[model samples]
Every structure is written in structure tokens, then in C-alpha cells.
Target chain A: DPQLHEYMKLDKKYRSIGFLSARTGGAPHVMAADEAVKATNTEVVSIEMARDTKGGAGHGATIIFAAEDVSDARRAVEITLEAVEKNFGNVYSSDAGHIELHYTARASMALEKGFNALVGKSFGIIVGAPAAIGLVMADTAVKTANVDVVTYASPNNGTARSNEIIISITGDSGAVKQSLLAAQEVGLSVLSSMGEIPKSGSTPTLI
Target chain B: DPQLHEYMKLDKKYRSIGFLSARTGGAPHVMAADEAVKATNTEVVSIEMARDTKGGAGHGATIIFAAEDVSDARRAVEITLEAVEKNFGNVYSSDAGHIELHYTARASMALEKGFNALVGKSFGIIVGAPAAIGLVMADTAVKTANVDVVTYASPNNGTARSNEIIISITGDSGAVKQSLLAAQEVGLSVLSSMGEIPKSGSTPTLI
Candidate 1:
């Protein structure tokens, strides 16, 4: 849509804005967005799947939430992250996929706003999934590790059904490591549950 | 990715720019970009798969071609389109898919830049399969029918493996009709060749 220049600013009441990009399933992305809005006092400012060349969910889904309080915004984002963290990369089919999650506690180089939104922080790389897994990962990384995204293809978005998602974040090397660890932990549990229903008697809450 | 705020000025010599987005397989997207550059006097400016969530090709792939001559740029885009047009939606497997192609010669509403880069041109829609078919369709429509795209989804990107692609273009009803017909014709030939070798002793040239 070429109305790319169209814009509006929220009043001071909506001074804080939270964004979530579930780079994976539309099912998960929509669900996460729904949960975020329902679980918090945030308003859905914009929500839509990507309309890239193929149009429609070509790039998965993105949601923006606005709140009067930054904490509320942050919390809403965290909720979305957790939702995506758990849902996006899971393989519900008979266990047929590999989950390659890595944990790095230290990094050497720093980057600027390279990941989804990380800035001036050395980054860690994220790769996993069937589609659009990077967005949700960033949502989680920012919340859990206080890192900024360095960025790139959520991974294998180019490869038809590469089943790999990748994301990079920047922060103190420790934060980058934490971000990677946090995402990898969730990835293992979710991807490991392929074809098996992991009991979720309790509603998913942001950690 | 946040350096989105950065800017550049193309020299007058490179005033013409062509962009191609193959919202489907990374293989096809890269091939198309390569073919575009090889086939014409255009320079590659940027090329990458989507990084929406899982990052890396989350949205397929996009390539930019810059040329001093408008024809070169347009031709480059057309070649990319033709390349994508032929490659993206094919099912090199036994025909197990349905090809739903529609032709609408008359459009009811006017839109402004709704599809790809189409401006208030009263659009026609395109939808077809595996991934990002809409983009290559737009490239064809713009070149062949002189129509603009009225957008919203290549379709089914949000849905995991829905195998659907959609895009809309705007123009005179006649042009819209032509665009649809042309795309449908191509889609039928390409998709119908599923799992079979359609002899292509002759290279694909823009019609």
C-alpha cells in the first residue's frame, strides 16, 4: 500500500507504544495479539499481516499496541512475546523437525538497531522455524534480555519451507547471551513437542 | 534495519529503478534477480529474502535494479517478473493442486497505490499459490496491461502453507481485464505443467 507516508501521533495518553511481530504462523500471531489486548490495558493501534510482493501474510503478521503507561505497553509486548515464543515454532505433526537452538553468553562485536529494534548493542543471532519466527523471537528478546535486534531474514525466509528462523539482537554481550538463551529454551520445549500435546492447564503468562 | 531513516540520491544517470519481489521460493527469487541483471543493463541495488519474524526470507525476496535508461529498468523488472511468473507457482510434483484464476475486466472501486505501486487505478486482484505469486503478477500487469496494483496480500502468507497467492491491480477496466487474462494464461501453463517437464527449448521472454 503506497499510503506509506500516512501518519498520526497519539495523544500523551498513548505516549507509549508496543509492537509485536510474530514472524511465524498467522494462527499464533493473531492469537498472541488477541491475548495481549485482552490481558492488558492497551489499545490496538494497528494490526495486519505483511502485504509484501505476494501480498497478504507474505511476511507474517505485525501488531502495535498503545498504552498510557509504558509499563502497560511493555507488559503487553511481553505477553505477545511469550505467546509467540511458545506457539510459532512448534511442530504439531508427528515429530519430524529439528530444533537447533544455541545459547551464547558472550559476544564480541556491537551493532546499531540491526535486529528488529536493538541499537548500538553487539548482537546474537537467532535461527529457527517454518516461517516468520524472527519477529516473535525479537519481541521475546527485547523483553527478557533488554537487548535490541541487530537483524536479517528471520532465516531461510528465502528457502521454500526452510523451517529455519533467525534473528539477531544487540546489547551488553551478557544481554545478547541472555536473549539467545531465553529464546533457545522456549524453542527447545516448543519444537520438542512436535505431535505431542504439552499440557497447558495454566494460561501462558509472561515471565 | 532501523537505518530505514537513512537516505540516498541516485544520480540522474541512474534515475530509473526497477524493483522485483518474488513472494515465493527463495530459489526462484534469486534466480529471477540474477536473470534480471544478466538480461539487462541494470545494476543490482539491494536484494534479500524477508526477515519478518524468524527473519531471513520471511517475506520471500526483493531485488532492486537501477539503470540509466527507463527501458532498461522496466525491462529488467519484466524479466524478473517473467522469471518469477514462471517459477514461483509451479508444483514440480504431480498435479495435486487447484489453479483458481479469475478475470475481472471491470473493477468497481478506485484505489490509490493499493497494490505494489499502483495508484488510484481501480484495481483487479490476483491470487494463486505456494508463495508471493502476486508480486510477479504485478510486474506482468504493469508491463503488459498498464494497470496499477490495488493491494492487500499475496494471500495466504498468514496461513501456513495455504498455498495461495493474491494481488490486485488498478487501471482501465480493459487493462485490468488484460492483466488478469495474461496472468491466468501464464498461470495455467505454468501450474498445469506440475510435475511434468514442459519443454522450454526457447527461453522465457516478456510477451
Candidate 2:
């Protein structure tokens, strides 16, 4: 019951979670996070290494925090940023290299639980094309294998490339491999049909 | 009480909300979404135009769906993808042009309510960085203005060029503009300090 109570607390806690993720250049993520927690009354939720193959951002660090309220959350984020800035030096922000801060309200439930459920499973990823095709590919992959859909991103949100759709799935290794192969078949078919085209128009030439 | 009840329904609905987003070529976003919805048993939550400034993805389309269950969601996604593939012949998928599929589980709270609460405000965005300085800049921006951070992205996540840190803040126009100016000052200082360095190791040479 205590564990159950604690698990239920995740929902309420997630609702108020204020998140600020910063990209740090060369700073050890653990060190940066430790400094942040030491400076503020916030909890570190996750720290992800930068391995953005699509944007070629290379090795960087991402840190997330859970705070008491919106204001407190912001304060935590601010503290973390300041700590990172003090520890490291060069820092920038842009559409590509970004710092995003927000409260997910209830969105934290998916982040907290969905991620736990999906981890340790093989992953199948398909990137590129409009959303329509991406959806089909994801659907096919799920149907082909006993995989769970983790997330599907559309460019409507400024976070993603407008001309791309990214879908990730997780399952057993065999299922994941099968899903990837199935999705690739669809992707290849789309690619082969496209042939080649000029760059100046709306029709994206298959890369 | 009714409003609270309705809001609670959103959490349940969000859990079941099967989302599918697609990036289209030259096709009109509205038309594509309409067609996808007409052909599927899902509800259209949002449709976004392709305005990817970073990747030069050009005018594209993104559509979201709320489905009955995971199976239904996948089916709807599949139908939409098929429709898009039928309409747009030259589709591609790569790091830059991607297709993503995922289920947020509890993360939908952020998508549903957090975004609504944050939207319609002026935005301040900063891109390019060394990460260390970026965090400081974001902290400064938030501290300087009565603004809330929408999102902070790290170059570690692939959407950004290496060595760049991007931050976005929102509030009143005046607050947003002030935040941008504050962050800019910090960025300029970092840029000035970095000057030029050898490319052999971690010290980045300004391009």
C-alpha cells in the first residue's frame, strides 16, 4: 500500500512538475545535475545524453527537474541553468539548440510510467516523410510485431523538422527487428517511387 | 465541479488519444487533414502547417488524432499514412525528414492543458551556444522578465547543431522581447569570449 500510495503520488507530483532542460557543452551531466539540486529545492527526474543523429548535435547533456509549483519549477530551472553556466562557459540557444521549460500538468504520467514500461525493449525507429505515411508505417510495425508505440512526433510542433515524422516503438528484440524491417519495406517503396526531383519545389526528393 | 469533471475526463481521454502527425510535401495541410479524418474513425485534434525554419523543410502538414484505443489509434494512423502516401508520391525518411510514432501515456496532460495555458503569448527564442552559457542565458531571461519558459532543448537531442543551446520563453510581448534581449547580451558575450580556437579537440572554432 505504501508503494501504491507512492506510485499514486507520481500522478499528482507529475502534474506540478516544472521542467527545464538545458544543453550543456562538455560538462559532466551528473556534476551539473548535482550542483542544480544542491542549489534548489527540486528533484532531478532524468538526464539524457545528446546523440541527435538527425540534427548532428553530437555529444551534449539534457537534464529534467521536478518542482513543487510553477514558480518553484521555474526557480529550479533557473538555478540549474545558472549552475551549468557557472560550471561551463560557451552557451547558445536557437531553434535547433533549444532550452524548453514547461509544466505538463498530467503529461508527466506518460513520461513517468510509459517510459518505465517501454524501457529495456528493443526500439524501432522510422524517420522522414509526411505524417500520413509515418502513421501507416508505425501502424504496420505495431501490427507486424507485438510492439508498443512509444511516441510519434509531427512537425506541427516547432520541436520537430516540418518535413519529417518520427515514430519509435519498443518490444522484444525479435519483434523490434521485425517491425523495423516491415517499416523499411514501406519506406523503401515510397523512396523508390519518388525517383529524383528538383530541390526548388514542395515535392521533397527522397534522400 | 462540472468543469473539473470535464477536465478529469481529459486525462482519461488523453490516455486513449492515439496521436498521428505527418509531414507533407507540397499538399495543402487543411485538405490533407480533412481527407485523413473523413477516411478514418478518429477525431482531429489539431492540424499544423509546415514551417520548419531550422531544417528548411518547407511548407508541410501535421495532423493529430484521438482514437478509441491503441489498436484503433494504430489503425487510424495507418489509414492516414496510406492516404498521404497515395497523395504525395515523393516521400522520404531520414534524420532530417523523419516519421515518428509514440504514445505518451501520461504525458498527454502537457499536450492538452499545458500547451493551452502557454499559448497566445509572445515568444523569445535563442539558438546557438556552448550549453554552459546557454543555461545561464535562459536563467537570466526568466529572471529578468515575468515570463514562463515554454521549452528548452539541448543540442544533445539531435535537432540542434552541436555546440548550440536553444531556449524559448513566452509571456506578454514586452516581456518576451525583453527576455530575448537579455539572452542576446549573454550570447554575444559568450561569442566574443570564445573567439577562435583550434579544431583538434573540445574547443570549438567559430565557423
Candidate 3:
């Protein structure tokens, strides 16, 4: 009975699980998820736009499917993917503006766990308005200097404004600093040139 | 002894709790929290920006404190409030653009819990990007029709992009439709006149 109980508990969690991370994340998966369920006898476990997309460097959403058999789980994932083939999300970084930076030479224990994995390491915080900016910043930081994006949050799961993206990149002190500067500089330059209004004032001035 | 154990468990939850919902919500409470802990013998329970600031129709944040005694908890809340008095958060709502709408006359049980309180009411959804639009839309809806703001979510705790705000208002079907149209019309007119760009494409081009 004890063994059966354990097995039953584990079984209830699901016998098989399949995952699909779309190219860019969004909530349209609900529509595609319906098609997935209708085509296969599987349950959609979770579906949401990811705080960070594009393999953790861009914007996108993810979905998980569970079933009693591996075939059913796999089929569900495949159907969802096919259903969304024509329309998927993408990180539109070029529209980003309102950049903010907070860099730490050495993270202390007082920092939130979002930065906990970065203790003792140097990290740079770059916030971009219009979440798409994270993709551009992440790409810029990693390419400009040897840094890894430790945290990527969009409005989907981050505390930023719905149009904002928060990126935390970590590396050696020198690299982090360099990466942050490059990312911030590039973001401001491009955004400003495009006439992005500053993040203050209520009405957009006709200027 | 059993009763004593129950009492101890309750004590761990805190003998007293004090709450302070700021006019707006954001993560800046971390700084105020530091000052509160330094000045009082209470624990800062939770602090964050609310999805809907200004009493569910505006933008803001909230903070909670707990302590072993009522006096300690109240003092912690006061200290935190006092520390943030000069720089409490506020919803910057005039900078909204990129709007989408989804309305439902009747809700099925499958709807997200955010709409549960509104399941039986005629609901109109208005989404504005940059998280500031919710304030304007919420204000307009209430003033234009006999409706109540049922759900308010921003990038802080919503599924929107960091710059988006989602507001759901409920009323009689006619009222819901009228309010939605009025709010939507006002938003589009003002935003468009301000040269608010559409939500497609990557870069903002000079018109």
C-alpha cells in the first residue's frame, strides 16, 4: 500500500511531460493550446509569456503539456507548435527607450535573490522600457564584453512597467562595467534618435 | 501543551500586523524598509508596487509590517511611511500608447481568476501600453458609465509588457459597452494626437 501510494502520487504529477518554448513569448498560446488538447489526449500544464525569451536572451512565451504517455505529450507539443507556426512572438527591441542603470561591483547578501546567484560577482542592471529593449541590451552586453545575463524579466513576471524589461548581467568587475556602459549607451543613443520621449510628464508633447 | 503549541505557531505568524498601501506601487519600498527595520523591532512583511495603483483605478504600491506587539508593528509602518513621505510612488499615466481590447458579456468558469469577481457582470477590457494608460481609462470608465473597476493590472504584477496596463470594468451590458467606447475613444484620440505610434513594427520611424 505504501509503495502504491507513492506511485500514485508520482503518477498524479503526470507520467510524461513535454515542453515547447516559442521563438518569442506571448499569451496567444491559449488559442494554440486548445488545438493541442483537441488533437491529443494531454493536459496543458502551464502556458505564459516568459519574462525573458529567445533562450533567455529575448522575449517569448513557453508552454508545457503532460499526459499519461510520452506519445500523447509529444503529440500535444507538436500540434501546439504547428498551430502557432504562422503567428509567433518576437522581441521588438528597436522600440525601446527609457533606460536606467544600477551597477554593483560586488553583490552583497542584502540583494534580492534575483541577484543572489551573482554574489561575489560584479553585475550590471540595465532597465529598458518596452521589454523589447532587454533583447537588444542582452545582445549588446554579451557581445561587448564577457558577461552572462543572469536575470531577464519582462512585465510578464518582472516588477517593471508593462513596457519595461529588466536585465541583470554578471561577469568580472571590469567586464561587467564595460558591458553595462556599452548596453546603456547603445540603448539611449538609438532610443533618443528615434524621438522616444523621456519617462516623465503625463502627456506626450507635440515637440 | 497542545494549546501552547498552537499559540506558538500563531505567534510565529506575528501577533500584530500593520499595512500601508501607498498612493502608488513599486519596488522602492526596499529603501524605506531598510529605514523601518533600523528604527523599529518589527519585520517588514511585504512591499511592492500594486498592479493597480490609486484604489484600483490608479497606479501605486503597498507595504506591510508585522511584529510581536501592536505598538512595534504600527511604529514600523509609521517609520516606513515617514521615510518615504518625501518620495512616495505615483502612477505616471499620461505616457500611454499601444492599446488592445477584449470584452466578454458573460464569463465561463475557464476565465482567469482575475475576472472571477466580474464573472456575472458585463465586462469590458481595455489595455494600454506603458502601464500609465490604466489610470486614464479607469477614470474615464467610471465617469462615463455606471461601472466598477474590477481588475487592474500593470507590469508590476500583470502579464502585460512592462509598459502595459490592463483594466477590466464591469456593469450592465449597455453600460459596459458605453463606458468602453467612451474610454477607448478618449484614449485613442488623445494618444493619437500626441503622435502615439502603433504597436506593430520594431523601430519607430520619423513620420
* Tens digits of per-residue lDDT for model 2, B37-149: 55556665654443332432223455556666666556656665555544332121222221111111122212222122233334444443334455556666777778666
Highest DockQ: which candidate? 2
Clashes of each: 60, 68, 26
lDDT of 2 at A29: 34
Name the best candidate (by TM-score): 1
Evaluate candidate 3 and give its CAPRI docking class based on DockQ. incorrect
For model 2 the local lDDT of residue B65 reads: 63
What lDDT score is found at residue A168 in candidate 3?
Answer: 73
Model 3 chain A: worst 10 consecutive residues (lDDT sum) = A198-207
Candidate 1 residue-wise lDDT, B120-195, digit = tens: 2344555444444445555565678777654545434432344455566666877877776677566655655565
Better of 1 and 3 by lDDT: 3
What is the DockQ of the complex in model 1?
0.02
lDDT of 1 by residue, A1-207 (tens): 123213644455577788866443433454455556667888767655553313322335667778888898899889877866565443222222233232223321111111233322354555444332333344455668566544444323432333334455566777777776677566545545545533322333222
lDDT of candidate 2? 0.43
Clashes counted in candidate 2 amount to 68
Angstrom error at residue A17, model 2:
15
Error of 1 at A145 (Å): 2.7
Runs with alpha carbons beyond 4 Å of true place in candidate 3: A1-97, A112-114, A160-163, A194-207, B1-207
Q: What is each candidate's DockQ, to 2 decimals? A: 0.02, 0.06, 0.01
> What TM-score does each of the candidates earn?
0.34, 0.32, 0.32
- Alpha-carbon deviation at B193 in model 3, angstroms: 24
Candidate 2 chain B, which ten residues in sequence have the lowest lDDT sum? B98-107
